[model samples]
Target: MHVPDGFIDAPTSAVAGVVAAGALAVSLRGARRELDERTAPLAGLVAAFIFAVQMLNFPVAAGTSGHLLGGALAAILVGPYTGVLCVSVVLLMQGVLFADGGLTALGVNITDMAVTTTVVAYAVFRALLSVLPRRRRAVTVASFVAALVSVPAAACVFTLVYAIGGTTDVPIGKVATAMIGVHVLIGVGEAVITALTVSAVVAVRPDLVHGARGLRQRLKLRVDGELVDVPAAAEPVAARTSRRTLWVTGLVTSLVLAGFVSFYASSSPDGLEKVAHDKGIDAGARPHTASGSPLAGYGVKDVADARLSGGLAGVIGVGVTVVAGSTVFWAVRRRRGTDVSPASTAGTGV
Candidate 1:
């Protein structure tokens, strides 16, 4: 959920800012281990795709809609640390460029949407994987459950945060109930989106799906009544799709989703916005600082045609998010290389 400014007081927001910064710092380091030549670029595409899919809000209830939070999808496709960074990048772009999320509440949004969702979803995903059959379908199943849980988890976290620093006097219990209740319905949408997206990628390039890695069972051959592992070379190699092809395909899909398909998305308020309006949580909400930006509210300034303006804004958002995410991930990948370089380690005895 994109928490707007003034929903939380300055002190609580400041603390959240510190927490967000620390989490991001740790994720940056952890991402080095997750990103490599094959997946770094993919991670960027994941972020852009998340940004695109989020624009296509689906109706959840009479007045509430839901969109992809992306944490579960990202974590399943990439890794959790990188997933956090991916969603955070989308949040940053939305806040500064689209004026959707408030700048002052950036930390709150990141903590609630990015950090909490990624942590909870990834935990659930791995736990399920441990017990479920190690197959592609199992991975998709885990993704669905993980995504389903993650949305309510985020709602709970937001409720907790609001209880501590809420500007209004709304009863905490009521807020929690309403928030969780509505988001539970929203979670279904999240689960479907996450599962379908993960399943599609796993089908095309299981190697590219980080969570699905190592899912293939080893070949067993019985010789003299004893089972032996098959030689690696003896195994038939599956036809491979090039990473560039997948990347291009994903980018094109994102463009199509955001640039055109987004026009048909439900226009009703999202889960958080609906809850806030219903519960008087927005009584203290302040205008976004970037509200005056040309791309504010996901539309180009002075654009006569609604379709063209929104399309342009969506396309621009995808382009910027992909570039920014790619730059960050590539730099992290480079840093990883530098850290293991022989020249850098030559002077220091291991």
Candidate 2:
């Protein structure tokens, strides 16, 4: 849920901002360990995909609806540190470009949505992977469970934030119940999308999915009634082919979701909006600073046709997000490369 400007006071907002900043700083370093050529690009695509899917909100209850939060998806697809950066990038874009999330509440949104969701989802994913059979199915199952939990965890985090900074007098318990309840439904959708996406990636490019990296079971041969594991070179060349093909496929799918499928998404308010309207939680909400921008509501300013306006917005958002995310990730990767260079390591390896 996007917390608007007036929802949280300056003091609380500042605290959230500091926390978010610290988390982001830590993610920057963690991402260095996570990013490689293949995964770096995927990180950017994950952000773009999250930005795209968020445009397609589906109705849930009377006034509430749900959309992809992308924390688990990103973590499963890329890695947790990079996943946090991905969702944070999407939040940043929505706040600055589309006027969706409030500028003043950016930190709150990042902390509750980005930090909490990524941490919880990744933790669940890793824990599940550790216990379950290290097969493709296990990765998918872990992705589903992680995604399912991440949403409700985010809802709880939001309730806590609201409890601390909310301008309204509503009971915290009610807010928590409503937030978690609706978000649980949203979590199901998140789990399905995440599992499907992660499965697809693991199928094509298991190496690309960080969570599935070591889960690839080595082929075994029975020799003298004993099974022996095969090494990488012994595998068929076709089996070890580069995943550029799958990367292209996933990228194409992301484009289709944003460029075409998004047009048919529901117009109803999402879970947060519905709950806020029903509970009078948004009574103190302030208009977004960019609400007056030409591209205010996910539609182009002067584009009269609703479909055309929204379509154009979605397309532009995808382009901008991809470019922005790619640039950031590429920079992170480059820094990592420099750090690992032989020249740089020469002096330290004595």
Candidate 3:
């Protein structure tokens, strides 16, 4: 959930910001091992896609809706480390441009949404992969379960954060109960989206799916009434398209989703908004900084038309998120490419 400003104290928010920044720093290093020539290019697309889907909120409860949190989908499609960076990039773009989340509460959002979800989802995914059969189905199943749990885990984590540094004098127990209860229903939507997206990716390019890596099972045979291990079969190469083609395709898909499809999304308030209203935690909510901007509130600044304004804002947001996310991922990929350069190695030897 995108926690607004005034919910948490400045010191706690600052601490969260530091924690998120540190985690991002570590993820940058870990991403080097995860992203290669094949996957690095897709990483940017993943971020853009996440940004797109997050805009289309679906109905959950009577008045509450939920959007795709995307931690599980990103982690399984890309890798955990890269997934963290992807969601963070989207959050940053939404905050600084779309004003979807508050700038002052950026750290809180990152800690609860990016860090906590990614960590829990990936951990659950890895554990599931270890026990489940090493097949594409297992990956999808794990994605579903991981996404389902991640949302509630994040809700719990946010409740804990508010308990520690809540601006209001609300009871922690009530907050926790409300938060978890509402978010659990939201988790079902998360699971469905995560599973479907992961399944789609795995079907097209299983090789690009980090969680599906090394999934080809070893051969087994019965010899002398005992089971014996045979050599694992060589996995077939995926029909992966070129990075340029994938990027273009991904950006096009994101544009289609946000620029057009988002118009049909439910108008109901999301889980967090509903819970905040019910629990009175939203009493001190501050106005968004970008409220005065023309593009604030997901509408175009002077576009008198509702559909046109919303469509334009959505288009701009997708374009901006793609550009920003692609830039960040491309830089990380370029630096990684340079780090393993032959010329640098030759110089080192000399």
User: Residue by residue across 171-245, what tens digits does model 3's lDDT show?
Assistant: 989999988998999999999998988887777777778999898445568999998767654444564665576
The Cα local distance difference test for each model comes to: 0.93, 0.86, 0.86
On residues 121-152, what C-alpha lDDT tens digit does candidate 1 reach at each position? 99999999999988778999999999999999
User: Candidate 3: deviation at residue 125, Å?
Assistant: 0.1
What is the TM-score of candidate 2? 0.93
**Residue pairs in steric clash, candidate 2?**
65-270, 65-271
Ranking by lDDT: 1, 2, 3
Tell me each candidate's TM-score. 0.94, 0.93, 0.91
Q: Give candidate 1 misplaced runs (Cα > 4 Å).
A: 217-238, 341-350
- Summed backbone clashes in each candidate are 0, 2, 0
Which whole-number lDDT from 0 to 100 does residue 19 have in model 3?
93
Top candidate when judged by lDDT against the true structure: 1
- Displacement of residue 277 (Cα, Å) in model 1 is 0.5
